[model samples]
Target: MSERRTIAIAGGGIGGLIAALALARGGMRVLVYERAARFAPFGAGIQLSPNASRVLYAFGLGKALATAASEPEGLIVRRGRDAQELARGPLKGFMGQRYGAPYLILHRADLHTILRVATEKEIDIDIEMGTAVADFALHKNGVTVLTERDHQLEEHRVAALIGADGLRSTVRARMFGNDQPRPAERTAWRALVPADQLPPEFAANNVGLWLGHDAHLVHYPLRGGSVINVVAVVADAWQATWTGDGWNSPGDKDELAGRFSAWAPQVRDLIDSLPSVTRWALADRKPLRRWGEGAVTLLGDAAHPMLPFLAQGGGMAIEDAMTLGRCLVRGEDVAVALRKYERLRRYRTARVQREARRMDRIYHYSNPMAALRDMVMGARSGQKMIERYNWLYRHKS
Candidate 1:
């Protein structure tokens, strides 16, 4: 590939890998830089709605995803205090039929593996482990990227630079200055339990949502029903006291259990059954008016980090990758193409970020507000509930 067609991507995450694959399919050579020495089995379960699955299938990953993912029958929303069902909505078949792609739930690691393997098979993609994008300089021809590996620095010039380094991204900091992400004042505790270890109700092939006062719980099957992934989010005031090596940190099982002690027996039992859990302090930033400048741009969390209330954090990233690839392949000036990509994606992603925050408020409603929410949700039929988010699910990009 010529220098004009080579793109350097910072961060070997889902967004970065997917961007590489998309760019490769568009006839561009891609180099992916990952700070980790190798991919590790990290993270819990992730819900890939039709919007995300559509892009992955377009990349010929349907078979790989089917092998590792679980297509849940539907989603069940309940009131946490008494486990009262508020709403039930279809997912698997309905989603595929309505939006042309299946909704999938799987371990985060499994999805990462599928993307990694797919990138490895692409001749135009090269992944460099144990390297991090330290800095970059944009010139008339291209961007010169400085990468660090074991305290040594190396420079590579590429037609464009993509900052997919995720939240707290070094690339983003360099591009827009270091504006700290606004904490959402909440913490998510996540764990995976063996299917056989829980009651049948907990192991059912459906996504479960339990909404409470200032907290919520979500669970679904993963890896072909071998394990059940669970996440509990609660209000936290101790962000200043949080100490950890990274966003994901070991959590106190007892502390998590106490948070849900007032809930129903099923909810309490679910918390108690977990052997251990990992936690992340939920946070996001106000949407950016611009994602990049000149030949350098941003993708995924690096561009727009959001709370996980709507389960579209990863989905939006996938959409960004596809949109960016389409924009870049138009043979326009690299900077202009990147700006076009930003224009195409900015509104949709900003809307999702706003919606996720709105959902965070809805899910954590207390008393009268919670009652009104349940009444409104319960009055709607399952199909109606699904249709409410048509804007989100019906998106092709």
Candidate 2:
């Protein structure tokens, strides 16, 4: 392949891998640099809204996803203190019928595997493990990328460079200068439990959300109903003291149980039954006015890290990959194409980011505000509740 037809991507996570598959299908040679020696099943469950599922199916991942993902029956919202049902929204068949795609809930690792396996099958994609994108320089011909591996450096010239690296992105820091991500002052504790270990109420084929004071809980079945993925978010003052390497740090089960002690018995029992748990501090950055310059840009968490309240983090990243691939394959100028991709994605992503932060506040309401929230939620029909997010679910890239 001509050097002018080659593109380099940093970070082989979901965004980078999906971008590789999309680019290769567009007849461009792709080089993916992943710092990890091997891919590990790290994160917990992720929800795939229709907007994201559309892109995955377009990339020909429908079969793999069908086998690995589960479409929940619906979503049930309840009060954490008394287990009072607030609202139940349609998901499984309703989502597909209305949005043209299904709402899927599955293990994050499974989706990563589906993307990785698809990328590996493409003849034009090459993955370099244990390598990181150290830096890059833009020249008249293209962008020259510097990659570091085991104290050694190598240079490769590609038509454009894409930074799909996560929160602490090296490529992003190099372009925009180093700055810390804003901490949300919240901690997320995650765990996976055997489906059989819990009572029948917890094993139902749907997503459960419990709202409380300064905390919220979300649980859903994963891995074809054999395991349940649980995530609890709570206000915490210990974020400043944490010195973990990455997001997945050991969590104290007792401490986690204590946080939910005042919750309903089912919720309390769910926490106590966990064999182990991992925790990560929740953080996000204000939307960037510009995501990239010249022939380089960012995708996924690297570009727009947001609070998980909206469940659109991975979905937005998937949309970015599809848009970037389409722009590059149009045979436009490399720098111009990148700018176009950013222009198309920046506004929508920023809105999602802002909305997620707003949801964070609503989910952890207290006293009068909590009561009002419940009353308003209860008045809306489940179908109307699902329809409220048509702008988010009906998107196509």
Candidate 3:
């Protein structure tokens, strides 16, 4: 019997590219439609925890990633006001030995470039940039993808559709009407500065998280330790008036400095020294019981958008791509394959989503509650702290 081999993937981000590569490796053809004119190195840095790293290694990009990525020695959780270390967890050799893959931190652009290059090399994958998927229709045999480019609407038929389109996914909206992303009541600012541009303190080869009242700051080395990627997430009064396009909007360093004015002097100095910053409002959709209908389904943020507190958003999306590809290759029917994929991923992603939200609250605790939280965190040994997240980092799919 002929296999349902051609798949349409909306979005060209990490998830979409990974899906394309994974599906192509399964001997299926892939078409990726991206709205960007080109796949430029965009966004700040992202951490690839052991769970996601395992998937990438399985995809055979281990060597490339190892060379391009910075493996942080460990994570240091600190009090945002005083820079006092609350807890520490190993990530370098410890994670590799424990989880069979090392934890990596790298520029988002570097990761995307690696995946995009890998996808381009596959014979069955084709990518179209500047083409946005406007809508899609599900049919008995396949899906018809409607895209808009240069004000022209075009349609293409495929055996299936994968909505890896990210947080504000059009395919997701069209599939389940009335579903819109809700602001997570947080805004983030990111800046990547050259290592030489910052003080020796910021050049540490470890991931640092400073948790404060209603705010948190994360920083780690990126691009093999040549740069430091810093992110600040704070409770903001900004309304949801943003139209989604303003994400990654150019931000003023002064405005960000004002927000972190009362933070530790080190943090304030870091913010002041940033050459520039980009601001984004974090938004997420409520988890859905099921992510697809017929031969179409959602992946990544489209399927489950969550808070960034857990640092597993990208990891979960990577796992989704691998699992979906494997299901498609194993199942005899397209719809059945997608259903199995959804079933396998829905619970896991939802749990991560909930955990992320919990982390958001935990990281923003204040005063007496904050002191109690610190004691609890400090009570755990580094190994125990890492073990606590073993369920998350040790996940295979």
Candidate 4:
């Protein structure tokens, strides 16, 4: 008896695209459906820690990723007049020691382009943009994907269905009803301004993180030190929304300053004096109750959406793509393989989501307890603190 061999991935963001590349290269046919009309180069930079970069390197993308990657000397976390030398896990030896891959920090656009282009060149995958997935019907043997057209919609069938679709994934909605997303009591403003445009002090080769009462500001260089990527997160009671490049969403500079008003001079000054910036609320979802059911499964943000505090959002998705691809390729039965993949991934991703939540709170600590925490960090060396996070970085899957 022959089992079905093809797979369908819904969503064309970083996760879906990478999954398409992985599954196709694994000798499985893959078709990726992207709901967006066009891919927008909107996101700021992403810190792809060693854990996820390991997967990227395995895809034979080490060289290409290296070209677009930026390596900061380390992290600098400040709280008011005091600061701490927090952990900066092995950026140097992460890849070689743990998974034979180095950590790569890159602008989201660069990674997107590299993955999309590399997949198109190396795999037999089909990508349809402006195609919104309306729903899916799980049958006895396979699943049928219904896609909405300009005026109508139609169905396409495949043996396996993967919902790499993002945050409010329709596929996940149909599979696991949309529950309340994790709210982190803050808004994150993202924007990319040229390095040359900012104050000379900001162009440093290190990552600057200013932690204040209820907010934090981060700055790092990008594109070979040509442009600076800055992200400011502050407390706001407003509902979390993507607000990405919307018509009413002006890239206002003043609002950026107002949020982190009482922050350290470096942070307040960085915000008020910045040439440009954009802002959006950060939201997350508790780990999905299930990642797979029969022939269909979820991946990346759809399955596990974490706050951006740990800078592992995209990296986790990349890891999900690689792990699922390898699992299916090696499993004996399609159904059995899917189940194993879910079991293996569910625990790890859930842990990461929790860790990210912890980081979000620690980054914005303001009370006396925060001072004690800061004192503890100052007394310890960065490497010692970093060692505590090896569990996160040293993970194989």
Best by lDDT: 2
The models' CA-based lDDT, in order, is 0.92, 0.94, 0.87, 0.76
Runs in model 4 with CA error above 4 Å? 1-3, 81-90, 93-99, 240-248
Q: Superposing all C-alpha atoms, what RMSD in Å does each candidate have to the true structure?
A: 1.0, 0.8, 1.6, 2.7
lDDT of 2 by residue, 25-63 (tens): 999999999999889986889999999999999988899
Query: TM-score of the candidate numbered 1?
Result: 0.98
Worst ten-residue run, lDDT, model 3?
237-246
Which parts of model 3 have CA positions greater than 4 angstroms off?
A: 1-3
Model 1 regions lying over 4 Å from their true place: none
* lDDT of candidate 2 at residue 386, scale 0 to 100: 86
Candidate 1 per-residue C-alpha lDDT over 1-397 given as tens digits, one digit per residue, 9 for 90 to 100: 7888999999999999999999999999999999999999988898999999999999999899879987899999998989899889998799999988999998888999999999989999999999999999999988999999999999999999999999999999998899988899899999999989899989999999998888999999988888999999998855657776666678899999889999999999988889899888889999999998999999999999999999999999999999999999989999999999999999999999999999999998888898888889889998898888999999987
| Candidate 2 least-lDDT 10 residues | 239-248
Ranking by TM-score: 2, 1, 3, 4
lDDT of 3 by residue, 1-397 (tens): 1326889999999999999988999988899999989877678788899899989989999888978897888888988888888888888899989988889988888899999889878989999999999998888888889999999999988889999988888998898885667888888988888888788878999998888888889999887788899999888746466655555577888888888888889999899789988888887777898899999999999899998888888999999999999999884689999999999999899999998988888888878888888889888887897898878988898
Worst 10 residues of 4 by lDDT: 240-249
